[model samples]
Target: MLKNDQKVFVLLENNNPQVESLSKQLEIPLITQKQIDSHRDGFFLAWRDNKLALFDIKSPKKGMSVEFDARSMEQPSWPAPKTGTLAQAIGKKTKTVVDATAGWGQDSFHVFRMGYQIVSIERSKIMAALLGDGFERLGNQSWIQQLNLKSPKLIVGNAIEILQNLEYIPDCIYLDPMFPAKRKKSALAKKPLVVLKGIVGEDEDKKDLFACALQVAGKRVVVKSPNYAEPLGGKPDLSFAGKLVRYDVYFKT
Candidate 1:
């Protein structure tokens, strides 16, 4: 259930059956863009520029959408070469990964582009819908079609429960739970993360989720956390530090 302050509605400009169906399925109101004024402080879901996007009422002009393409402006190439901190954390030998906390799906998509089999799990209905739409778009990309590439499989449910019931054991279980900012700073947080926090709240049970991942992961469990925050599952077997985040890996003996 959504928080009182995080009310979300679906915006339909015309007789869009697909949007209408999505609104019904999500149990959110379907309204026109004009109607958005009434819910001036709420967030909205709409199709903008041929992609499903989430718009905050405060900044409707700057909506957030999932994109599988390379994020760096300098690197316009698709399927960026996987030789970074994330790849190091996931390990060179890891073939299958289960992203147990796939918020926004940026990490999962990155790993997928690296040719690793990925399964993404998202609990929020809104995030799941956005991810589903993004994956569908990824599947239709010319490069993806020509190479017969498949997008990461998405599973919508509580990760604590889903991790235990996975049909196949994955080589690595990755967790990137939301952690509170270390200190209040002058710079505003990223729009996508701010909007996501408002909608999904924080992951208070991340430790429990980490514990569960340890039990189910075939080889190792990787927990991504703010560099300043304490590790979720005690001391890690190895830790890889990035610019603002760290990946703590716990190997299964």
Candidate 2:
């Protein structure tokens, strides 16, 4: 069994005084580690916040793998269409998407499965490492070989810079950033997410992300928000409903 004592130095978001103050005021833990390495292959960073147990690898870009349950990769089955997913929203108008905040690549995978080509970006090296590993595993899956599932093309670096330089503008740019959890009582209980949150920190630059997404998207930008949080970048011209939240859409001219 892999020991839990593994530790690596990662820049803590709370290392900044202002960040630390906010973490204390908001009561959010900061991120601080990179995880498991393989001698033959590259290392992976664990997304502690994700319940899905996703791990992205450290190197080898493009056709990156995403590992969900080991069982799911080996077995051929489509992930249930998350009915109210952002994929469904943008899929209606665009055949391609850029997940500007790819994170653990959950939403990016969903977008790809919905038949849209995806360009995903992540800034955190640890998160990118985890994502890279996950994509490598995803690429090697027997089912993926048999069925030819669409795999994400991941780029490690700031989306704000990468998106601006992309040759083609995608139909949609999706953002599912880290927002303050709804309630403090509800926060402490999300164990899987807590770990990830500790490592990635909150999406401190969500505002810039939204602006950049708006500029780069061909048709529109969809921002996923908790039901209780205010719409990002003000009210959306249109919105699609989900049980617990809404997809706020900002159409581009």
What are the TM-scores, per candidate, against the unseen true structure? 0.92, 0.69
Task: Report the number of the highest-TM-score candidate.
Answer: 1
Weakest 10 consecutive residues, lDDT, candidate 1?
A: 69-78
Over 4 Å off, model 2 = 1-66, 69-83, 187-189
Q: Give the Å error, residue 96, model 2.
A: 0.8
Model 1, CA-based lDDT = 0.85
Worst window of 10 by summed lDDT in candidate 2: 1-10
- Residue lDDT tens for model 2, 1-253: 0111132222243334443443343233434433223323322222232311233234313222344655555557664454555755675658778888887777777676556778889876556666766777677767777777646888988888998999997888888887888787574434435445655668778899899889888899999878888999898878887777688888887
Q: Per-model C-alpha lDDT, please?
A: 0.85, 0.65
